[model samples]
Target: MNDQSEQERWNARYADDSYLFGTSPNAFLASQRHLLASGQRALAVADGEGRNGVWLAEQRLHVTAVDFSPAALAKARRLAESRGVEVSFVQADLATWEWKESSFDVVAAIFIQFADPPLREAIFQGIRRTLAPGGLLLLQGYRPEQIQYGTGGPPHAENMYTAAMLREAFRGFEMVSLVEHDSVIQEGAGHHGVSALVDLVARKRA
Candidate 1:
């Protein structure tokens, strides 16, 4: 689907009075929270409904949540308000967003899927360029094997990720952790129950 169509689809999905992905950080991120540095600027890309972004803000990280859906951004704002935390929301397509270089101390990407190889490469490059020296990146996404689990994730196998894919994407970075595992995700209607996923944490060399 084109960017506009994709945005519209997500907007419609989130337009209802339901929290699609629930109000919590990804299981992998929450598990590794101790490894994250405090008081650093963080960016949450494709942060639909602001769950993870709001959680980051609550952790005292300066946060900016970016997504193409205004509906999702509106819900994100509401979530931030309820949590009594501040998070900057940017409505833009990640494929075209002018990501800044060396600007963020941490970049968190959870469940953001892209089937187009070029677009995926571009997004990964953007993530790499947007990180500050010694910055860290925390990522979690469904693996192709997830189709068997039938829990959640994109229908296209190409949209799914693998540890090898992430290792190749962030080749130059210091890989702190990279693994494919099974875990129970209790997000909401969209993401729930047992899931097959790849999780990674990499740091930019200073």
Candidate 2:
């Protein structure tokens, strides 16, 4: 898909009075809060509607949320203001974004599977470069089995992630934990039901 078209599509989804995904942190992210420290810099990739980013700010993590949709970023800012927490919301396509090396202590990427294989590889590589040494990386993506569940996520198997794929992507990093399982997700109208989940927590070597 064309990058512009993808951005426009997401913007349309976010062009609503309410958040597409309700204003709460992802389950995987909430579970790993203990790994984050107050005042640590965090980056929320494709943080549509700002749910996770706002939650991180509430946890006192200095968060920078990036997405391709202006409409989404606007909603994210509104969510941040309503929560009375400050977060830097940047509108950029992650594929081309100039990810600063060793800039963030935590990189929280929830469910962004819009990239194809080549772009996904670039994104994975950029994710590594963007984190500070020993920085925690929290990620959750749908597994191929999600197609059967029909709860959420892309239909293409290639877009889905596996534990082995994640392990290989961050081979040099400390694999704090990785798991594949099924869980009920009640985030919002967007994603709600029994879903196949792949959760990973890895850290850049210090």
Candidate 3:
């Protein structure tokens, strides 16, 4: 999809009066809170509606939430204010964003599967480069089998993930944990129902 169309699509998705994905953090991300350190620099890639980003701020991470949708970023800002915490939200396309080197101690890449295969590698590499050594990468996405679930996520299988796909995409990280399973996710109207999922948490080599 072209930039304008993609932007408009996401804008409409977030334009809803209710947050598409409730204000709560992702279960996978919240469960791994013990891995986060206080006051670390963090980045929330494609953080729609700011739930994850706001949650990270609550954990004391200085967070920068980046997304192509202005409406989404606006919602994220409101979420931060409502929580009495703060986070920086940037409007930019991950496909071409100049991801700085070793800038963040943590990178949250939950459910950002908009990119195609080629762009997917670029996004993953950018996140890898953006993380400081020993930093953690927390990610979760729908597997290609999600198409069978008839739930949320892109209809295209190419936009979906697989264990081998992510393993190769982020190979050098210390293999902390990676799981592929079936689970019921009830984030909101955007993402709900039993789905094929992949959850990963790994650390960059020091």
Q: Would you estimate the TM-scores of all the predictions?
A: 0.96, 0.97, 0.98
Question: Would you list the clashing residue pairs of candidate 1?
Answer: none
State the C-alpha lDDT per candidate.
Answer: 0.89, 0.92, 0.92
Q: Which clashing pairs does model 3 show?
A: none
* Per-residue C-alpha lDDT of model 1 across residues 1-206, encoded as one tens digit per residue: 66778878888999987789998877777777787667889999999999999999988899999988999999999999999999999998888899899999999999888436677888899999999999999999999888888888777788889898899899999999998999898898998889998889999999
lDDT of 1: 0.89
Error of 1 at 177 (Å): 0.7
> Tens digit of lDDT per residue, candidate 2, span 23-93?
88898999998888999999999998899999999999999999999998899998899999999999998
Which candidate order results from sorting by TM-score in descending order? Answer: 3, 2, 1
Better by lDDT, candidate 3 or 1: 3
lDDT order, best first, reads 3, 2, 1
